[model samples]
Target: MKVLVTGSQGFIGKNLLAELKNKEFPEILEVNRKTEQSTLDKYCKEAEFVFHLAGVNRPEDQSEFMDGNYGFTSILLETLKKQKNTCPILISSSIQAELDNPYGVSKKAGEDLLFEYSEETGAKVLVYRLPNVFGKWCRPNYNSAVATFCHNVAHDLSINVNDPSVEMNLVYIDDLIGEFINALNGKENTRGDFCEVPVVHVTTLGEIVELIYSFKKSREERTIPNMSKAFTKKLYSTYLSYLPSKQFSYDLKMNVDHRGSFTEFIKTPDRGQVSVNISKPGITKGNHWHHTKNEKFLVVSGEGVIRFRRIGTEEIIEYFVSGNKLEVVDIPTGYTHNIENLGETDLVTIMWVNEYFNPEKPDTYYLEV
Candidate 1:
């Protein structure tokens, strides 16, 4: 079904769009404050549902919040009311709407306007009050506490917490997106004028901070250096993996060709041959070296650390792997290397080699680790 989604550029909106697309929603008409009227009207007319999610989420000025959130929503509702053919309207409200903050007040006003418009126009309306949603591709900044916390922890930075014991409920972004898709599909019957809707309550700030701190502490205890890109991706991937839904995991595995079976993707025609297996936790692999081959790998499943020593070099490189990321280190013809599964689940990988596999005279030479 065709759906028009406002605030298409925002975090939640972007995630919702992806979710809908993944579910094979026929078409998505994206709309935002910057979206032109002609474009908005075109999509609204063709859509079977309109998800209103645009407007300023956290404005520095209270008035900006009012104008951007409440005012913009009013205008959109008015426009929809005038449509020759109306569709169900879903407003992406915030849990903050129940609070006293300006951002919350504006969202509350926006919801009120949606109800009023639905009453006047006989349009179906659904409101979703989202809590602290976290997951992949989330921006780390002042706008999102979870993102900021994850960012700091991924970088080995200390997390400052006002209270470390409070607990809060966290709704994964994928879960929130699933709810929106469910709403659009009419999986849940709607009452007249408005629906009671679903609200996800997240943990208290202290609890959230502690969770992140625990991850950081674990990484440190393992003597894993935060290797920028690879490590950050690993942490984020792990965070997403913990979400209580298989929708994302399934899609990711498909995209990465992770079928719980070994597969090899040749990087160059003759330079390398690479194969990977998704093994259970605590399984140690690759305690061997090549006399003439070099290799590289990226962890695509659970977390782990690699310990390697180069010939004629007293220093050893200890690297941690997590998430979905690429890590490269040369074997220098004859150096001992091995990786330990530090995570609880199977360790997965996309490994690359400098030469094709040969059973006999195979580049690999066994070494004691």
Candidate 2:
């Protein structure tokens, strides 16, 4: 399919065009403010589907709103009409169109024009009255507060919260593209003259700020947010994408001693914790058994021998592990286990426990393995 996307360099345009290319659309025509009329004429004549995403939200002069949103739309449609083309056209409108403002008025005028054209030519037109759209690539300090907040928080800058109680209706970029693709497949969620993205999230302005703050603090906390919630998961991923390239790495606290060091990598309330343990040569660790704090240990450096014995039985089991052949040794609840460094170099083991340690109610008990 030959898909023509207006505002092809914009946030939504970039996302949609990438997805279209990924879907293996044969040909794509990109149009932007700088696009020549001759190129638009050719694209209008050849495009099988038109994503009318070009619009002006912020302009120094108010008249430019109409010129960009309504005027450009008129030009595109008229060119399509002159070419006698009736391919499907999907327009990205805003919920503000219902209000009486310059931008809203321009968007509404564009919608009116598309409807009139659809009526006159009987061409398929899907008008989307989108809420605040956000995700990666959205321009900061633009129309989307979510984008501004994510960017500001990721950069350690202050975010303006004009109204803490104000709730925002957000449509993710991926969700918007999914809806657009559905419209392309002739399966639009339409009602009257407008179409809708099936999935949207609602959150208060204050909560959005809090969520982003938590994401930044996750580095120091060595933890992750609750991912079972759909909105949070998507928002967190979006938040991470906004982090500065140089800020990607964060330091973790490591405890070092003669037996080497141990560091907690990440801790989650429901998923337990992961830690790195380094044992010095000729040193042994974990001559203990747990009632329920089972663990999985994988030696990633040097060589070690992990020995285990049933709590009440005399039978002993031993497993030799090395960096050359990585393997995980499971420490069962009723088994006494110990890992001893056998190589000349220190042994580094990645460990995962079913739960984090609690000094008040430690499940471990010292026992010879």
Candidate 3:
């Protein structure tokens, strides 16, 4: 079905478009702020579903709020009303509309305009009043307190609230998207009905902040090497007792072994090795090569192409490896390579490396093949 999404560049709009794409919905016309009225009308004419989301939620001036929120929606509704075939238009209103803020007042005006237009012209208008939404890809400066808390927690900063007791409902962005999808897929016979949509109260602000604190604390605990004196002493005693020879050197050594054949060993250290594995069929791994570290690969299973290009040169090298005929191939530093798994099963490889990986100072460079 053809769907037209307005304000497709905004935070919520971008996410909603992604969700629609993932669902394999056909023909999603993204209408951004730069979209002209002519262009919008053209798409709306062909669309079976129109999601009117173009509007400024927060404005510095109250007058600007009217122009952005109410004005933009009114124009869009009028355009749809002018169409020969009336399509189901879903308007994303805000819970703020029920409140006394200027932003809320403008949204309420838009909502009223939609209902009036719907009644006069037999337009299928479904209004969704959303609460505070939170999830991945959320921005902090926006009207989402949960997102602000998440960002603060991610940076290991303590969250301080002006009113910790204030209870605010939180709904996941994906859940909000689900509600939109359900409304979109509902039968046409239920179009004109003024449905009191369900509001999902996922969590309060206090609970959300506490959850962030707990997650941050857990992450911090994992980083402490020597947890306690008693634990360290016990570990040392066990290590000494396990040694078979008395002539063993005081030099500490660590060895790590990775399970599975698909992992390509890049560097082998005393304790462990760095590895890379491509699980998707017909998908390529790194397109870049490292200059400072040597990499060894053993294809455990499946089949794929290992393509490499030398640094500063356009020369390309290709290798086809499979699980049964597994061999350790050393990719020297200064060469860029990516592995493409060609088999149905996971194309696994074990990489062994001596140094820890760092993206910023990466000795790796990419070249187009």
lDDT tens per residue, model 1, 160-273: 777766665566666667677777788743445344335444447875565566554533332222325342334445454333343232211122333244555433334455
TM-score of 1: 0.58
Off by over 4 Å in 1: 189-202, 217-369
Model 2 score (lDDT): 0.93
- Count residue pairs with overlapping backbones in model 3: 28
Backbone clashes in each candidate structure, one number apiece?
9, 0, 28
TM-score winner, 1 or 2: 2
Which runs of model 3 end up more than 4 angstroms from their true locations? 187-199, 222-369
> Model 3, range 1-369, lDDT digits (tens) per residue?
999998888767887899999999979988988998889889878889888877786568779989988998877877776776578788878878889988899989999998898788886788877667666565566776766676665554566788777887655666667777887897322324444335455445665566556444433332112324332222223222323354233322223233222332322223335555545665666777666767777788788777777777878888888888978877877787877788887777766664645577766666655
Look at candidate 2 and tell me the lDDT of residue 351.
96
Cα error, residue 293 of model 3, in Å, equals 42
Which model, 2 or 3, shows the larger lDDT? 2
Alpha carbon lDDT of each predicted model: 0.69, 0.93, 0.68
lDDT of 2 by residue, 90-117 (tens): 9999999999999999999999999999
Name the lDDT value of residue 121 in candidate 1: 80
Error of 3 at 247 (Å): 42
The numbered model that scores best in TM-score is 2
Which stretch of 10 consecutive residues in model 3 shows the poorest summed lDDT?
218-227
Task: State the weakest 10-residue window (summed lDDT) of model 1.
Answer: 246-255
Please provide TM-scores, in order, for all candidate models, with all chains considered together. Answer: 0.58, 0.93, 0.58
